[model samples]
Target: MINSTQVSYFILVAYFDTGALKYLYFMIVMSLYMLIVGANLLLIVVICLNRSLHEPMYLFLCSLFVNELYGSTGLFPFLLLQILSDIHTVSAPFCYLQIFCVHFYGSVQFFTLGVMSYDRYLAICHPLQYHIRMTSSKVAILTAFIWLYSVLATVVMMSLSVPLQRCGNTIEKVYCDNYSIVKLACSDTTVSNIFGLVYIFTVIFGLVILILYTYMRILKVCFSGSKQTRQKAVSTCTPHLASLLSFAFGSFFEIVQGRFNMSRVPIMFRIFLSLYWLTCQPLFTPVLYGLNMSKIRIISKILYLGRRM
Candidate 1:
């Protein structure tokens, strides 16, 4: 089934048929990328500079922002460059790296969302034990584990892609998503497809279930608390909930699109889907962080005043 004479590089046909629309597309995407980068960077700076934000939630918010920043870089920048330059070709090694980074950061997003859920669960369910359970060293270890496991999971997905030689050179989307790339394999991908399905269902789906269950319990605990405590708990949980909702829903849409045997989906729809997935995590994290942290609000006020002065 393996062929040695197959293509070594894939020509991504992403957004090529747009004719005059390509320029408009580039302008829109570049603007969104700038907004994402700027928002995430601002949040990171605020969290780092504000001593009052030295807490568990803000710490995880920082990690989420970092992951989103790296993740977006792993994807959007190269694609944006290519789109602008009208270059669609990608080398095999670079293609593999693209797949690795996509899945790696995708896995990290799921894991970080799960961590955020657990953080909220602890804060709402056991307010007194929250600090003790989520201690600085413990948070460090959990963050380390998120990075480690993300790499391992990405390794599994990436390792499965290397040996499959490319017969055709056309990739449908901006980035080299595993399933899309694997479909072009000259060899059998039955095993790799199965492995990917299992990973998605068990690792990614499992994380989603855990997050939902944790949040449900958190909501129960909050409702059972005193009025003031309940209000405070609701306020604390809102940002995490918003992030989880966006991540989960956007991911669900992507997975559904991937699984469905339909090529008839509009190119514009595909483009928007890619744009949403790339932009939402990076952009929303900062908004959620600023809303959740009083220190960030205070810092923003001080900056505004300083600018005026």
Candidate 2:
């Protein structure tokens, strides 16, 4: 029986032999990490400084931007260091910590999006009651619930896996993932597998359904209303929908990579698919929201001009 203390570290075997391009890879990844941080932080700061943007929608956006930073922070620093270093290994505890952070990021993201969807639903479908229903206090509670719920879920999942006897010390992915680590266990993982699947379906599909239902109702209302209503719906909902689709696609690709045999695919493409959710969503979400939402755009422009002056 391999005890937890016996396993010092696990090897990460995701990077390819980019003999001469390692430097380029490091620089590219570093630049992307910087961009993700800078863009998300800028939006967060802008939202905080401008009291006009303190409504439920913007508050939810702030939560999302913060999660983007949180999620990327979990992976980017370690990834950059691994890209530069020859040996890609992470200590067991740090690996589990990474798993917690990454999964926590994912859970909070879905919950936050669900909350955003609910906010939109109330704002559009119940306009008269919107303000009263989604008060500042309520919004804060909901956001807090999202983070807390996610943390609890991740902790439960990690606890289920921590006691399993690990037979191997190698992870095949770029970062420590719960599923990847669980696969290393020598003991039977049927319970963990079942729990993970249940958790995935319950959380991912449930949120996806909630989002779709809200949009469908919104669409119905928009169609029955005036042209202005339709345009307003399109402008506001497009970013969220786009963001949803982006996250779904990235997540889908990741799931496929994990479940299917990827031996036939190009190594680089596999790498891209594996890191897509972490990389693209954080980088593009702020851009999408910042550009598409009129209030945010105006505020961003004002901040930019003020900085120049």
Candidate 3:
């Protein structure tokens, strides 16, 4: 029986045995990674430099962009290295680190979205009190709480897994996840599994429910209001909803893929599904927000034209 202390590395068996196409796979992943970084950084930079965007909403968006970068960085660099190398092994410490970062990204993301939804709710439903309700200090505190809460949650999850007696060093995924790591434990993982499920439901589903309730209220207020008010509400809320749905789809698919036997699914499709959230959400967010938000679009145009000049 092997223990956690004896395990030095985990072999990842999720890569495609692409034979001659490995180079192609590498190039594709590299390209996507570059795009994700570039898009996210651009959003972050634009938000930072533009004085007009230094509000609670843009500040939250900046945090979201940064989270996207953090999440992708945790996975992409390691994945790229694995693609070029023959060995798919990751050191246990690094695996746990990756687990922390990826999960932190997810938790922070949902929390940030929840904050954004609440921001919208206040701005739309309680227009007169919006400024007082979402003051800069309050927003800053909320953002800090989002990050710190995520870190605490991830730390607890990782700490729970560290004491388990690991029997195997093989993970069947391209990246490290808590579930995959816990599944390798030799001893009973009932506590970890139960806690994990409860954590997921309480965090992810709780945020989802909060978002739904907030949006529902916003919708109700929009319907009872005037034409211009409806347009304003829709314009402001569309990007948030789009981002929410995009993330939800990716998360849902990844969870389903992880929990079920996907043997019948085509290998390429399976791979895509597994990585869809990490790859797509980071790219989807900036593009959706930059294009949909009029102020952001205008600022982006100015930046583009300035670079051209």
Per-candidate clash tally:
0, 0, 0
The per-model lDDT (C-alpha) reads 0.79, 0.88, 0.89
Task: Please tell me which predicted candidate would have the highest lDDT against the true structure.
Answer: 3
After superposition on all C-alphas, the RMSD of every candidate to the true structure, in Å, is 2.2, 1.4, 1.4
Q: Give the candidate order by descending lDDT.
A: 3, 2, 1
Task: Give the per-residue lDDT digits (tens) of candidate 2, residues 1-309.
Answer: 676668889999986577878899889999999999999999999899989999999999999999999999999999888888888899989999998998899888878878888888888889899999999999999999999999899999998998788888888888888878777788888888888889878877788789889989999989899898888888888888888788889888887887778888988898888898888989999999988887888988888999999
Which stretches of candidate 3 lie above 4 Å from their native place? none
- Give per-model TM-scores: 0.91, 0.96, 0.95
Query: Model 1 lDDT vs. the true structure?
Result: 0.79
Model 3 clash count equals: 0
* Residue runs of model 2 more than 4 Å from their true location after superposition: none
Better of 2 and 3 by lDDT: 3
lDDT of 1 by residue, 120-234 (tens): 8888788899889999898889889999988987787777777776677677777777777777778878788888789878877788788879978877876777898788877
